[model samples]
Every structure is written in C-alpha cells, then in structure tokens.
Target: MKNIIITGTSRGIGYELAWQFADAGHNVLAISRKTPQTLLGNKNITCLSVDLSDETEMEKVDNFLSHSWKTVDIIIHNAGSLLLKPFSETSQEDFENIYKVNVFGVANLTRACLPYLQKGSHVVTISSMGGIQGSLKFAGLAAYSSSKGAVITLSELLAEEYKEKGVSFNVLALGAVQTEMLQEAFPGYEAPITAKEMADYIFDFALTGNKYYNGKVLQVSSTNP
Candidate 1:
C-alpha cells in the first residue's frame, strides 16, 4: 500500500525487501547495479539500474524517482560494501569506494528524494552489530564498520532534522544472515539466520516506526544472540 524505494536490490537484503514489499501489495522501486532475473515479471515492482557508488549519477536517481513515483513513503538504503582485509592490507581505493556508497550515496539519494517524501514517510538504513561494537573476529572490517557507523549516525541526524515534519529515520543493525554478501565475507561459514527471515522481521519492524524506535538501532540475529 506504500510506495517504497529500496537500494541494493541486486541481491541479499535489498532483493528480499523488494520482493517482500511487493508481495505485501506495495509499489516498490528496486534500484541496483543490475536487475535480478527473479524480479523481472512483477507488475507492482519497478527495477532501476543504478551505480550508487557513482555520485555523478545521482541525477539519474532523481530522474528515476521523479518519473516513476509521485510520492515516496519509504526509502530503504540497504546498499553496503565490505572490505575484509586488515587495515594494513586495505587500499585507499577500497576506503573511497566503501564510503562512496555506504555514506555519500545515501546522503545524496536522500537529499534528492526529500522533496517528494511526505510527512509520514520513513527512511531506513541497514547497519551492523560490527558497526555497533567492533568485533575482534571481524579483522578486516575497519572500512565497512566505520561506514556503517556513519549510517547509524546519519539516521539519527535525519530523524532530528525531520522530526517536526513527522518523518522518521531508523537503522537496523543486522547480525549475520545467510546471504551472498555473508558468504563472500566469510566463505565456508554457516549462519543460523536466513536473509528471508531477516527481511521478514525488518518489514514487520518497519510497521512500528514509533518515535522511540526512530533514530535507534534495531539489531536482529538468530535466537537474539
């Protein structure tokens, strides 16, 4: 019933959210670097190919938003990157790319869409527990973790700035879910949670965009661990 814009829809949480929302009867704007074959036939879903890391392409994002949707009820920034190399091994290019999407891309997209966001609109970003509290197990996550932390902080600031207008901003600090990204991050590792389950919970949690939940981190994991 809502018009939602979701980024990173090529796979993982973004793809799941796009389908879930479409199944719930909402009109979904699914943006990603490439359109997924699975979502090509959905009438209620519109897929946009976007390179979110390219800040220069923000105008394309705006044009897409303007053409496809008149009003945006939700904006879910689920696009993220992971650099799993030790700080010493991480390259400057990796840092820039991570920040480009994880930080600046979100900022630019939101700014461009704000003009269309109604008073009751919601803006959500996916964060991580690693961003919440750095884990020693996550050896090469400095760039990714800091970018996520930036997301959480940005959500808080957005909530404050838009509080008077009845718009809400929230962050979901997700734990490991069985997704391609997880597999890529920790190859050969097993996870107790699936991306579908995580997406389901996130969709439900979004229904309760109370002021208390706004500007807060909703961390989800298997068995609440």
Candidate 2:
C-alpha cells in the first residue's frame, strides 16, 4: 500500500478523501487544523493537527514525515482558505491570509515533503473553477480566486521543474462542491456535486494519474456555470 499525505482533512473534501484512501488500504498522513471527527480511531490513518499556514506547525509535519516514512507516493494539497468580499472592500490583510493558506502553505508543505517523494510520485493541488478566467466569476470572491489562481500557476511550474525526477504535478480546479466553504461563499445556492463524489474522483486520479497526465490544470465540474 502507498503512503499518502493529504492536507485539510478535518472536514469537507479533505476528510472524505482521507477516509476513502484509508479504506482502500493506503497509509494516510492526514493533516488539518484539527482532527477529523469521523477518523478518530482508524488504524490506517494518522492525524496531524497543523495550521498549514504557520511555518512552525508545518515544521512539525516535516519532522514527522522525515522520521516515520521512507517514501511518499502521493501528496494531495487539499487545504485551503476562502474570504469573500467585494474587491474594493477586501483588505491587504485579507488577501494575505487567503494566500497564506492556499498558496504559500502548499509550497511550504511540498518543500518539506520533497525528500520523501520518490520516483513516480504524484502531487495534486486542488484549485477552483473560480480561478479560471471567464469562468463564472463571483463578485465577492476576489481574494479567494486570486489565491487559487496562484496555486495553478505554481503547480505548473513545479511540474516542469520536477519532470526529470519522475515526479508528476497537476492541479484540480474544482467546481462548487457542496461543503461548508461553498455554503459560506454562496449561502442560498446548491452545488451539483457532493464532497464524497469529488473525493472518489480525486482518489482515483491520485492513484493512476501519473500514467496519462501531468503539468495540467483540470477542471472538475458538472454544470455549465
């Protein structure tokens, strides 16, 4: 079984992804700000409480991985932050906070995990459809969208830089999946896909995507919007 690392596992898509991977017999290093409520006692899962945006907390994660595992097969960057407000009203602090978790956190964690990632390993970072230009732009999500955009670009550059190492990097630009974050972003709107559904797709991709894809930003959406 492969040893996998997934961030933002406390809730939503990240939590579901952790469960699916563990159930499939993979050793999952689940990281989040808090332990997932449903994953309290699973043997295949190890939970690390970490604020990915904080360097100190991420250092602990790096240390754990360094000592615990000889190799990592998949690294899924699912942890993210969102802030919704009109661009004119969005503060510098608000923008930075979003970037800290969504962009910088991914970079920091990936760097920390690089040593353990061997040949044929896959790195998947979750972006958003909102980040794509001309794709259902929402007025209040300027900061969130911009950060996700940065994630896509970063993943592309890493993919190019790491191709010779047999490491594959890709970004999944997801549409609105029903989750707390989506509810917060658009209170009355309903998403077409559920978190578990998205998790299934992601888990499958993470397992076999290196064979057919890399250096790509794929959009996962069920609706035109």
Candidate 3:
C-alpha cells in the first residue's frame, strides 16, 4: 500500500480523505490543527496536530517519515483559510494570515516533505473554482481566493521544475462542496456535492492522475457559487 500525506484532516474533505485512504489499506498521515476523534486508534492512519504555518511544526513531519516510512507516494495540500469580508474593510494582516495557511503553509510543508518524495510521487494542491481565471468571482473572498490562485501557480511552477525528477504536481480547483467551512460562510446555501463524494474523486486522482497529468489545473465544479 502507498504511504500518503494529507493536510487539513480535522474536518470536511480532509477528514474523509484520511479515512478513505486508510480503509482502502493505504498508509495515511493526517495533519490538522486538532486530531480527529475517530482516527485515534487506527493503525493505518497517523494523526498529527500541527500549525502548518510554522516551520518548526513542519519538522515533525520529517521526523515521522524518517522514523516510520521510507517514502511518501502522495502529498495532498488541502489546508486552507477563508476570509469573507468586503475588500474595503480587509486588512493587510488579514491577507497575511490567509496566505500563511493557504499559500506559504503549502510551500513550507512541501519543502519539508521533499526528501521523502520519490520519482513516482504526486503532489496535489487543493485550489478553488473561485481562484480560476475567468471564472465567477465573489467580492468578499479577495484574500481567500487570491491565496488559492497563488497555490495553483505554485504547483505549476513546481511541476516544471520537477519534470525530469519524475515527480508530478497538479492542482484541483474545487467548486462548492458541502463542508463545514462552507456552511459557516453561507449557512443555507446548498452545494452541488458533498465532502465524501469529492474525497472519493480526490482519492482516486491522487493515486493515478500523475501518470497522465502534470502541472494541470482541474476545475471540479458544477456551478458558480
């Protein structure tokens, strides 16, 4: 079974992803701010509670791989921060906070995990449909969507840099999925998909998509929400 690393695993899609991978017999390292209550006893799943924005905390990831596994087959950058405020009222600190978790965190964690990633490894950075150019845009998500957009570009650049090394990098620009983050942002709005459904798609993609794609952004959405 493949050893997989998934970030943002305390809730929503990240939580589902960890369970799905473990249930399918793949080794999973689930990282989040707080460990998932149900995943505590699973042998196939290891939970790490960490602040991804901190370089010091990221060292624990290196330690885990060095002590437990030989290589990481898949790395999914799923952690994100959302700020829904009018552009006029958005502060620079707000932008920094959002970018810290959404963009910089992804970069930092990927860098730390680089040594364990082999030729066939796949790095998937989760993005948003709102981050896609020419897609529908929302006013209050200037910071959130901009950070997501930045990661897509980051993945593309990494893909080109690693092409000869045989590592693949891709971005999934997801549309609205019925996640806790979405419910908190828009209480009554119904999303076209559920977290588990999207997790299934991502689980399969992370396993085999690298064979056919590298540096590609797949926009997974049904509507503009």
User: In model 2, which range of ten residues has the least summed lDDT?
Assistant: 55-64
Model 1 lowest lDDT segment of ten: 130-139
Tens-digit lDDT string for candidate 3 (98-124): 999999999999998888999999999
Tell me the TM-score of each prediction against the true structure.
Answer: 0.94, 0.97, 0.98
User: Positional deviation of 51 in candidate 2, in angstroms?
Assistant: 0.9
Compared with the true structure, what per-residue lDDT tens digits does model 2 show for residues 1-225?
A: 999999989889999999999999999999998886679789999998988888777788777887887789999999989887889999999998999999999999899888888889999999999988778988888999989999899999999999999999998999989998889877988889999999999999999988899999889999786
TM-score of 3: 0.98
lDDT measured at residue 219 in model 2 versus the true structure, 0 to 100: 92
Number of clashing pairs per prediction, in order: 0, 0, 0
Q: For each candidate in the order shown, give its overall lDDT on alpha carbons.
A: 0.84, 0.91, 0.94
**Candidate 1 per-residue C-alpha lDDT over 1-225 given as tens digits, one digit per residue, 9 for 90 to 100:** 889889989998889999999998999989888899899899889888888888777788788777877788888898888878889988889899999989998998898888888777888888887778544236788899889888888999998998898889998888888889889989998788888888888787665565457777777655443
| Shift of residue 86 alpha carbon in model 1, Å | 1.2
Point to the candidate with the largest TM-score. Answer: 3
Stretches off by above 4 angstroms in model 1 are 134-137, 223-225
lDDT: worst 10-residue window of model 3:
216-225
Instruction: List the candidates ranked by TM-score, beginning with the highest.
Output: 3, 2, 1
- Name the candidate that leads on lDDT: 3
Which residue pairs come into collision in candidate 1? none
In angstroms, give how far residue 174 of model 2 lies from its true place.
0.5
